[model samples]
Target: MAKRFQIFLIVCLSISTVTFMLLWQGQKNNKDDIRALAQASAADACIQFTEYQTNGCESSYWYGVAAFRSFQQAYHSLTEGTNKAANYTFCNEVYGCLVLSPEISQSNISEIIETMSILSSDVEDENGYIRMSELRNSLTR
Candidate 1:
């Protein structure tokens, strides 16, 4: 009976240790991913700015769309385990910066890109889809 008790205790301890280690590693990985994402966001901003300057409005719009798509895909992938709020916030920050840039004034190109960025970053499930839809309708005007 004494030997059986010892074995049970040891097994419990081992399982507990392994569980803690896994949890710690998971947290560390999440932190690293967030850091990498922030760096990527900044880098994308700089590149998009340059591309817009050299490639013109149409090219710049495409770049914005591509970047948004990339973020959307990433958010969906991580939704199972990651914080959806943080993901949306990150997307919104990058989107707003790109869209609100002075280089994309209404006199030349559509300013709806800025609004779309704002909508995409919404945490309360209020992505500016309605506004974006309206803007699209006005594009032919």
Candidate 2:
């Protein structure tokens, strides 16, 4: 009985230690993980937007809208606790785009496609955050 109890306690301690280490590691990389996810979402949105532009299908347009929303949500999550001016500005720019006009002109579609392409390119570069700031600047202008 004593031997069994000793083995059981050792097993429990090992499992708890592993769990704690995993939790600690996850916490350490939480921000990086969120950034990666947001980048991926942005890329997806860009692809969807491009498809809409190429196909000119109503469904494709809706898909692009949905993907853009996902990208926005992920970005918002990444900046939730921060009070950065750039973050707010970027969010506002994204929100303004989200409010679609009933009739999208060709120029507006071209601009959206161009913006999404820039955003997706950020995912490929190491300086994605800086690129995103640049995107905000372009949008504001």
| Candidate 2 structure quality by residue, lDDT tens digits, 32-71 | 7766776777777677767777887767666766776676
What is the RMSD, in Å, between candidate 2 and the native fold over all Cα?
A: 5.1
TM-score of 1: 0.39
Each model's total of backbone clashes: 1, 0
lDDT of 2 at 106: 26
TM-score of each: 0.39, 0.59
Number of the top TM-score candidate: 2
Candidate 1 lDDT, tens digit per residue, 25-136? 8885574464345335434533554456456766665575465546544544445365555545545544453456534333323345444444334412434445443444
Candidate 1 residue 85 C-alpha distance from true site, Å: 9.3
For model 1, give the RMSD to the true fold.
8.2
User: Per-residue lDDT for 83 in model 1?
Assistant: 55
> Once superposed on the true structure, which residue ranges of model 2 sit more than 4 Å away at CA?
1-29, 83-89, 96-107, 123-141
Against the true structure, candidate 2 has what lDDT? 0.63
